[model samples]
Target: MLIARWIFDIDTIDGRSAADVQGAAPAVVLDESVRVVPGRDGEALAFDGRAQAVIPAAPQLVLSQVFGFALAFFVNVTAPPDGEWRGLLYKPVGENDARGVGMWLYPDAMRVRGQVFTAKGPDYVDSRTSLRVGEWTHVAFVADADGMYLYIDGRLDVGVPLEHEVVPPYGPIYLGGQPDRPGFTGLLDDLRVYASALDAGTVQALARPPS
Candidate 1:
């Protein structure tokens, strides 16, 4: 089931808040640097490597058995020389423990990567190939009892075995940036969170352009 969705179709983050289409609490914008601009569908939220939005923690946001998320993103420019990592989506468990699921862009490589942390260890997967700059791409990351899967443009890119089941990260969802990590320097739209992992057919349907 779709738990949380942020379409970012509004012209502005009115009152510093963006509506969650699924009826969740509005996401609070972090700063003024974030802007609403043209997106693959309607409008997208732009992050200039400094701003972000936070969705308060809710019981439904926590997933243990199966879950996944998909988003449309367009990288505006390459990362600065000093940029090491920039977060696209992050939900952490603790400040010191490796217990979270996150997807980020390796700006320098222009590649997308996803990771999941469990009691056993962390599993990682990446697109292996670079994405074209200035173009919107649909990316999805799914975690199930079998393993973790990374899909780009609705196609399976890679999968990594989950040594241990995912430990639900109980925390607020951070979009486009994190408090400690570099913010994503790009446009993000159609962010969706699901309680169940999406299958290949459904993922393909999501990647299709809106009519």
Candidate 2:
């Protein structure tokens, strides 16, 4: 059975708010909530490239040992300016410090990127391939003792060390975008966060279209 710390699926979709399907954590749609659109599978939550969904900092997300974690989601690129970096998900730590780990799109590189932020420093990795615009693609960001891994369409795109252990960000997770970066303008579906790094096979299985 597929398991995850948090799963946000079609049942969680809302016009102005979203609730985790397997937990109590809820995310508030900010700045004029995005629209709901037919997803590559069942249903998806859409972002306007300017709006976001915020999940407050709580026990469900705040962990002391984030040694290994992976975030997976499906997206359809739509209207990001060429060469711009767009945020997919992030967690803010503080003002002086960069926000916590996040997933973003590097349009120029035509690939997805993963970033981790903590008091010690930050770590990042870029996916090897570009996202086919206007098409649904599955992406994941993973971090463990070995390193940070970026998966695109269920394939390992990048794998690099995540440096040493560092304090995790103590804050909420932002979906679609962050304050400093522009959010993705398109469809987002089947968002999930796992406590442990998922292997390539599991990730590939996740990429399978929902039934």
Candidate 3:
């Protein structure tokens, strides 16, 4: 499998802090509040209010790591399913595997409710945290070689194997809800995707705000 490099820096929108960064490979600027700016050390992108953006993956890019947060609402993706779960919001996969996509939430108690269907079967994963609202948190999913690892606020929350081989005509990754479905109702910031598996430390580093 060939891995491609892509970067998205949110610093061009209005009301956003000016940080020098490499923006998204294929990104969308929703409202006028968000902007890409130069960060003290790196590039910084800021979000002021509700906005939506999508980054197109390389044709052969296999999603392995996703890092970002839904400032107020939630971001979503379209993982085109092959068999039973036909047209649902799923994670992306390579040509060989057919297991569904994986996602992780942060701040401990944030609610993540969605429908996941697979050839093997379908299931649900909920939130578990004790933090108050408005607290900044981080979440990551390492879906590939090993399996699925869900990280909440930089810590491991759940890890499971590929319940089923997630084959595709995989759909595009949607931000803020499944395309054509009910849209997400919140703010998303610092979103990123990688073609390789990111270890715990790497995931943590990506989650941290630019210093």
Candidate 1 CA-lDDT value: 0.72
Winner on lDDT (1 vs 3): 1
The candidates, ranked best first by lDDT, are 1, 2, 3
Candidate 2 lDDT: 0.72
lDDT scores in order = 0.72, 0.72, 0.38
lDDT of 3 at 40: 28
Q: For model 1, how does the per-residue alpha-carbon lDDT over 1-211 read when each residue is reduced to its tens digit? A: 7877778787435667777777864465546777887777788888888788787777777867554433333344334424477788887875444538888878577777888777777778887756666777788888888788877887888887776777777777787768767866777788888888888898888888789
Q: How many backbone clashes does candidate 1 have?
A: 0
Please provide the root mean square deviation of candidate 3 (C-alpha atoms, Å). 8.9
Once superposed on the true structure, which residue ranges of model 2 sit more than 4 Å away at CA? 1-11, 28-30, 63-67, 94-97
- Every model's Cα RMSD, please? 2.6, 2.7, 8.9
Best by TM-score: 1
After aligning candidate 1 to the native by TM-score, how far in Å is the CA of 16 from where it should be? 0.9
The TM-score of predicted model 2 comes to 0.86
Q: How many clashes (backbone N, Cα, C below 3 Å) per candidate? A: 0, 1, 41
